[model samples]
Target: MTLSSLPAPAAPTVSPWTLSAFWFGTAFHWLLLLIILIPANVVGFVGEANKGTYLGALTAVGAIMALVLPPLVGAHSDRTGKRLPYIRLGLAVNLAGLGVMALAASLMTGTNGFLVYVLGFLLVQFGNNYATAPYSALIPQLVPPSLRGRYSGVMGMLQAVGQLLGAVVAFAVGTLNLPVFVSFAVIAVVLLVPALITMRGVPETATPAPELAAGPTLSWQQLFSYQPFLWVFITRVLFALGQYSVQPFLQYYSVDVLNQKDGVTASSLLAGCIIVASILSAFLGGRISDRVGRKPVIYVAGTTMALTAILLLIAPGFGTALALAVVFGLGFGAFTSVDWALGSDAMPSAKSYARDMGIWHVAFVGPQFIGAPQGALLDWGNRQGDNLGYTLVFGIAAAFFMLGVLLVRNVPDTAHVKTAKA
Candidate 1:
């Protein structure tokens, strides 16, 4: 069937509160994984010296799962014309993974523990991606083109709030020295409550079976030929690469570079600074993009992030690092706020919303697959003395941010381009 022949349902306008609720839980889970759970698990399993390499390997493997699973699941969701069912299934599986992870944490300090932890991590990745792939279609399916920037802003705000909560959770964990099982239980509750709220709050309309059967299908040839989507995808990949380069290693960086004895607390504080700053910028950035163009806001935001990363490289003390974290947060918030709007604008066909969004998701996870391996490089640089690995990695990240900013100029703004209906 031709794309133009498919029915275009009039999408009801949704409030920002309702539109952004689900992202709270999703972002919360991600924050915990990257900032708290995975790092601690790896460090406990291996001593500090080996932590980087092992953590990198574990993240790489998990990234592979994230890279591959979502697009396939989203395609299936498109075929079935269902999203909520997959979301529910994902929640169940994610909970089960948490249970396994709790068990693995109990056995910390052993090879067996590490292996079991890897298993749980993979399960978590699987569940999260499965849910997120289809859920990502909601913005395109529901919001009008004009309102997407505002909707995306609200989404970014909620996500930043979720990250803040995650940082709080990390603080509690560190202060109380919570047991592994207890920590997992806390995460499970945090994840479940918001997700349930979202499911109940957002309304979904299923495509009729005839429409589902006749909807335009995606092909490899069409995928590469879609210029706007391709450019957006590449830009997203570069931005994410810059993020992952610094994200997973902050705890180690605190301990080694800043000479902080309490790495967890220090890292949490840094994250809190970032999240707090991001919260301030996210909504404003989105709203601004609605008035100005997405590309301009992205240009400013990207430059800020790149500059802040460079400053972080030369920071002399933990206090200085904290300040830089806040600056980086401002840029990160604005970039993320407008990012979804840009991607939604670039979509080629409404019929393939889930599938295309899932493919776009690869731009986020795929970078982790490549960047996580830099842990080896980090270790090698540190071994050479003066913590040069961090300097090298952060430099690379800054370069990536600049490159992403430059490349984004090639993608036409939503106001100028119409989504393909072929």
Candidate 2:
């Protein structure tokens, strides 16, 4: 069942839609491309691109930029005491970047595929990455602590919805892929404009603890000083890398391996299962994290994501793979269920929420650059008769989960920050 079908959390002070907006961002945020790319991410890189390495390198450059932009912009926002300016500017970048990608994709289909493909992908990623930095950090200002877990669940749920919608939508529009993608982006932008307009005068909460902000004087060194916060970045990077490897290859498995005809039925079912499970997991998982603790949830998600990735690799057919998608989504829902709250806790700077989040974002976005191509290459190599190549990639994904377990092990749980209702 979809998380949207689940009962509401106990009375939250923040209007439900506010939290819903936060959660909904996930689904709508990249609703434009994720669905089409998610199942096809692997195929696009390995089979279609035929130049994974070059495309990967370019994607990496853009991904890296996204990683670093958040903290810088956020800190600047903190200094300015305003975030909308940066938000608006970044949104503009997002629009321009999507436009380039559409243009690039259109060009690649006919000829000179390599150069145009790389450039378009790079531009789209660059814009999204840059914009996302400040976007994530802005959450704290919007949601209250009593509702962090619930809010996070909403965020996770919306994201899954986006995936479900995007996947089904993509299959229908694959023939008109370019315009479909552009329209998706355009709609996202339209949604964003209204959201931002709503948030125009809305104030976000800053750090309540004096020690965390240094008695009113905020400094970058103090912000970066928290080692645990840095550790979040470490885990984020691993998560991104592992995710990247699996996402791009899913399409390849369906098309080249399973030999499924290109249709919304197959893609939608695949995307739908993963997202549906993820949203359910995300909703309950966030509250569970709130109850038992965040670290435990992270562990659950990490291991689940890792195991499922491997299962898909070893499984004999699409049925098993589809089943695993549900499992994978469950794991992801659990981890990300409270990930944003955990991320906020790790932030060392009050003023630069976006900046620090942005800096931390690298761990999430960077891997996509390398992971996509690497998965493709491994698949490409395995297609040549070496099982170890693909196996190794999945293995590494699992290893990253293990590594994340270690990274968050020492992190202090925020359970006492607010007790969950019995």
Name the lDDT of candidate 1.
Answer: 0.83
Q: RMSD for each model, in Å, please?
A: 2.8, 6.4
In the range 20-96, model 1's lDDT, one tens digit per residue, is 78788888888987878889888888978888889888888889878898889989988788888988999899889
Error of 2 at 12 (Å): 9.3
In model 1, the Cα lDDT at residue 28 comes to 86
Could you tell me every candidate's TM-score relative to the true structure?
0.94, 0.81
Q: Model 2 — which ten-residue stretch has the worst lDDT? A: 1-10
For model 2, the superposed segments whose C-alpha errors exceed 4 Å read 1-16, 19-51, 107-117, 142-144, 175-225, 263-268, 372-376, 386-388, 415-422
**Which sections of candidate 1 miss by over 4 Å?**
1-13, 204-215, 415-422
- Give the number of the best model, judged by TM-score: 1
